[model samples]
Target: MTMLEERPLDEPFAADPATARRQAATSPETADRPRSISSRTFDDRMSLGGSAVASLCLVWLLYTVVLPMSGKLGFVLLWFVAFVLLYAGVTAVSQPGPVVRDRIASAVIQGGAAVVLLVLVFTVAYTFVRGFPAYRHLNFFTQDMSSAGPSDPLTQGGIKHAVVGSLIELGIAVLIALPLGLTTAVFMTEIGGRFGRIVRTIVESMTALPDLVAGLFIYAFLLIALGQERNGFAAAVALSITMLPIIARSADVVLRIVPGGLREASLALGASHWRTVWSVVLPTARPGLATALILGMARGIGETAPVLIVSQPSAYFESNPFHNPMNSLPLFAYTGIRAPDTNSHTRGFGAACVLLATVIVLFVVIRILARQRRARDARPRPWTRLARRASS
Candidate 1:
């Protein structure tokens, strides 16, 4: 009370005039300073706009100014290089070094993907355009080359025999390769041991073996050694050989990636190893296995040398795989294109288009099957439903 009476009560709380002025001057400077890097925000729209504008300008400049001087052959390369550099530089102006680097990398990857998609679209469009003349004729799909001469119009000839042969041979090849490949994959991934390693090594080695070599092997074994005639069966054998390694290796990799905990859980629940693999592992990896099969089919279906070497290309329909020569889409296209006639050339293109369509159809079917499997897996099983009902 004595001390408070000695000095005014407000004196202790009041700021000195000089210190208050210094604080007032420093506050604005502190507030105006730039934020830390962690607090900074990037304008993605601005970056994207700048990148697009720079890419367009660079492409135009090259097309108009640089092409005359440098030639048009390297336009794509130049454009790619210019766009990447310009985009990176533009981003760097507003972003940190790491962010700029990431942006550049993403741009390059996206550009490459776009280029690939464009190339695929262009190829399909060009093939369809060139083949439309023959494809438009209904007979081109209903008749055989045997009934039509080289001088005949597109309406007179078709790929019926080749289509039949191709289907029969590919069917045989898949029937033989699928089970063997799946078993080998299971052995490699689930039953890994010394034998599995040896099998894996052999599969890896076989993957690099030439298609022609496989054809020659089958040709020698079946036609030369066994004194058998050229037939669709022999062609199917060669195709199976070519397809086996592809399916086995791809499936092995797919199966290996299936969660080990699932297998352990199954085993702990008193299931046998084989049962666990069949019920749990295979079901989990079925979609991936289907993809592997598709790859195998794609590799085998387009092979001309194997079918050409092992089976004589037939012009007439021959459904028997074991006795007589057989025709296929690849052989049909090859033989047709060799004929010195415009109609024949058109037929060849038409056959190629048909083959392409067949592949597309197969891919769509496989995708649908995969989607159905995924949907089925997402639904509760009957046992699971029963268990839930019992619990309730």
Candidate 2:
């Protein structure tokens, strides 16, 4: 105290300005800068504005540049960029104090990256809006591709054959893959030992194998066994193999996430492990299993490589699975690309749009079913009270 007083008195004690300000604003003993109200407000507002602008710029860029130009890769990139920018902006805006300012520039950079994504989505949408009007009719869905010729501009060729082929193949593949995949998943999740681990590793690795490889494997195996060439049945087998790995992995993950407590409770009640798994575990995981099946079906339906390798193209409709080559939506698109006229091109685009629509419809149906199931489970049960009464 004595030394401080002496030092201060030397200059008439004008008071070290920073020290005085700090003492008045916050801690009397600590040395720090006192920020004015206007300065703090300005900094905060500037940061918020920058963040907003950055977010908007990112969205704008994505819609304008990347979507229409990039195909599948572009679509994925746009989604990633859009989500990242949006999350960054939200985080920046919600953060407390000075740290909020730091994220603004980062937001700007991310936003810039999103510009290409914006362009891509917009271009695709624009193309759809323009071309969709040409094929948006019931005639497109109800007719077969057989009646139309290469020179016919407005003739009545329908997607019926292609639709039938797609549905049949998809159905067969789903029927074959679901049970096999579900069984494999159950084994991997419930069974223990080195054997289970090996099986799981093999399933996981199969998920990464190319569709063409799966097609070739099936083609070679069947060709050797039955001494026959590729056909619709062959295509279905290939699709099943390709889809099985994905379904198994997804279902395994879902089952593994189930709580051990549930399993223990079922077993403690004298339920066999197999019974508990089938009744309790599977019922609980039904939604995930359905989702996996849907994904498998979708993948198999759109697979061009396996279909191309195993099934020959058909200009005419063939209802018999074994007698003739099956013409699917994917194969139809492939054929259209090689056709030497405007009619073929139009049909290709229309078929593509329909295929895309079908995938979307399946996804929507799954979502609706999931929601309904969830709602049913969420509702209070009159049956529970009835059961309690009966027991008592």
- The 0-to-1 C-alpha lDDT of every candidate, in the order given, reads 0.86, 0.74
Query: Which TM-score value belongs to model 1?
Result: 0.82
Q: Give candidate 2's error at residue 144 in angstroms.
A: 2.1
Per-residue lDDT of 269 in model 1: 66
Poorest stretch of ten by lDDT in candidate 2: 383-392
Q: What TM-scores do the predictions have? A: 0.82, 0.72
- Model 2 agreement with the true structure over 11-124: per-residue lDDT tens digits: 333266544433444444333654443344554556556655665567556666654454565655555556555555554443434444445465457656677788877865
Candidate 2 segments exceeding 4 Å error: 1-134, 378-392
Total clashing residue pairs per candidate?
Answer: 0, 20
Highest-scoring model, TM-score? 1
